[model samples]
Target: MQRLATALQIEHDASLRTLNTFGLPAVARTLVRIDSARAVRRVVDHPEYGRAPKLVLGGGSNMVFTRDVSPVVLKVEVRGRRLVEERPDAWIVEAGAGENWHDFVAWTLAQGWPGLENLALIPGTVGAAPVQNIGAYGIELKDRFESLSTVDLVTGRSVTLDARTCAFGYRDSVFKQEGFGGLAGKSVITHVRFRLPRPWQPVLGYLELERRMHETGNFAPDAQTVFGWVCDIRRGKLPDPSDVGNAGSFFKNPVVTVEQCRDIIGRDPAVVHYPMPDGSVKLAAGWLIDACGWKGKSVGRAGVYEKQALVLVNRGGASGAEVVTLARAIQESVYGRFGIRLEPEPVIV
Candidate 1:
């Protein structure tokens, strides 16, 4: 029998293990694939599923499911990309929310706009980028963002929001917020626009990129070179999701005040940290985890990635509950030693 909820097709008892990078076993009670702005509205107007709780899923790279999902899952698959505008100072490009983030970055460079090169090879969708405020190798999504369009769940109205309204911060945005003016679980992003600056300047101050420069004797590299370098660096550090089931960085680097930083440095001078412009310091979560001797360690079927302590991998057939157990253990150990609690990066379901 053909199952239809108005214009939307619903999948019952949908397997989510294949959708998420962690590859944990779970099922979505109801699932719908959204490919356009109208499709999102259809979901909002549906009779039964409309008012029920909904979960907007992107690339599923940053999600961990601990149990069968009860909320309706709207898997965004909207697609398209094009050059929007070219001004003297910048070239504006746009892409559908569902576009693969890494692919879009590569596509922008191919089209001769090169500002997104440093962010190459990051997993997840373009829609998820702004939500996570994704960053890498000295560049962040906000660094090249212009604006994005979203469909409100209640009103079914499409609105365009700028960076200010998005309230982008370290791995966070209004999309992840839930107080007054928060958009979390309230809207679905349909399209995203990027303000790629006209004159491409390679962002190469990052340690790994700098080391690459020193090794290659190339003080100045093009966008493609930087892209290659970032891909190589990430490949060496992070295990591919295909080979190992794991979400990318499991925790956000804890930011501390100058006094706290000094105290930590006093206790452990070898701690890896980055000083921010605001005078606070960001300590590497991976370094803290490794210091606690958690790398390559496991709790049941879940374990820390042998290559990067910041990542939790499914050794094989691991349950999401086991993964959470492993994460908590790491957090407890790190807090015991450094007196700092690590916040997870992925959305735990």
Candidate 2:
């Protein structure tokens, strides 16, 4: 770890509390920010630190490091943008993984690109988008994901993986699975490429977005209008982590057997369920938590967001343990009430 500072300013005693949205105070053993693939390779291939575990980090939005850092923290700072390819009506934009996601979306909209408008105002970096297929307002990152380029730490070589190779699923990609080094301090995402639609129709399939569009009396919506609507909806719903610490959607909507959903719905017909193609049903995790009476409840410094049950906020100086404890209590209560165990979406370290 001593040679880590040669590649970048390796900061010890770095307060990661500000880095993460959770605002949980923790220390990193060694933290280095890499601006290029060469710098990443240098740290990963160092013979002195042979086989030591590495953690890759981006904007530090969707993670909860419950304890002090365990391994080296390598913040991916690679940044750039280019028009990789263009057609008569569409274009492929490539950006460094570390680029701010909202900035990229706004840039695309300014250029009159239409596909990314629905995903406006999403938190995190472009590099982390492909991992979870980040989505909102009826559009997902997978809808435009062309390919992603990454550097393999073990071999210190670069590789470009196409969308199919990415293994994208509902809020999941190959990089997110266990043993895939998807967690922080493990694998670095260097660059991301997106294919944008030229004359795209505004997706207003989401109920709230649709209702807002109707209320605005917009019969025919364009990219900019849709982007504005999305930004408005997100701002009205999700609390900005900068002002109030929170990771949006603390839990993934649990997918369960169709029979399981039917059984639960029989008792409470108002329970919402989305039928899946795989003969399963997706239950709204937020609805389940609200039903369990955990919404707006606070314990210590952590509490469920008063407006959105899916978000858990750090009202004050909450420790990671307290947040996790509150989350566990919600999980247990929901399970006890509905027999469905909710799983957290963000990676908790």
Candidate 3:
């Protein structure tokens, strides 16, 4: 086991093929494994790497590497989990940054915690959760986020950030922001805490979950059952990255105003649109791509998933450049048809 302040083992020319869920080919010139907050500080204080450009690599479930990485790769492997506090109103749970998101959700359910059940089966690490503001089945990480501990790369100072400080937005957070006061690429998250409220309420607002209830005749299901349903739903809808090299939901659902949505509906009455509480409508990216006739289509080795157009899959031997090219084409077509620019969900490196 590597210690925090021990001399770091820096691997050279490291292959990132298996590290990323997309299974894209790429190599890092220099890579360091950070298993603790102190390890991050140690790297920051190191004479050689203290000032070098850094790239924090998580599960790589939400990234597209276009070429070989030039920045120093910090592979976070911090690990720990504990029930921080049990209150009458809620249970506060903490997990290390490296903990697998899905596994953590299942662990919480196994321990009788229920809030995270709606977010089950989502890939990536707990650390990357805040960066992407990950959400599914009507629950976003911000809904249950307490605070997170991160060490600044420049100052080597550790800070705990609350939800407000995180500046969480739709599929975004301060950590993902590179604007004023943003922490993007400037710090490394070491741990995250989640507050699960008592008197658990199952989030059954999503349509697919409702459909599952209708089909199974199990309307009032428990958290464990909901977790199982989510896993089943995702498996049926999204392709497994293990079987096929791909990133899940390559594009974010485009949100438009009610008026804009009405315009789109006027053009295509069958457009799938969901109304938001804030008067905006979220158009299904899959529907938009499928409407553009991109489903099951291929450009070189990169192709739109036959089952779900939102996902772009690598048929075989596909380069990251090809994936980006296909994504750009899809974006252009969708924009031309709907007059709404679809944003990509994954970070393109």
Full-model lDDT for every candidate? 0.93, 0.82, 0.92
Q: lDDT tens string, model 1, 180-221?
A: 889989999999999999777889989999999999999999
Candidate 1 stretches with Cα past 4 Å from truth are 1-5
User: Which stretches in model 2 have alpha-carbon errors above 4 Å?
Assistant: 1-6, 180-186, 277-279
Residue pairs of candidate 1 with colliding backbone atoms: none
* Candidate achieving higher lDDT, 1 or 3: 1
lDDT of 3 by residue, 192-253 (tens): 99999998999998999999999999999999999999999999989888899887989999
TM-score of each: 0.98, 0.94, 0.98
| Arranged by TM-score, best first | 1, 3, 2
Locate the minimum summed-lDDT window of 10 residues in model 3.
Answer: 1-10
Q: What is the C-alpha lDDT profile of model 2 across 181-203, one tens digit per residue?
A: 44324457899999887667677
Clashes of each: 0, 7, 0
- Each prediction's RMSD over C-alphas, in Å, is 1.1, 2.1, 1.6
Query: Sort by lDDT, best first: what order?
Result: 1, 3, 2
Cα deviation at 133, candidate 1, in Å, is: 0.3
Q: Extract clashing residue pairs from model 2.
A: 54-185, 54-186, 55-184, 55-185, 55-186, 56-185, 56-186
Worst 10 residues of 1 by lDDT: 1-10
* Candidate 3 TM-score, true structure as reference: 0.98
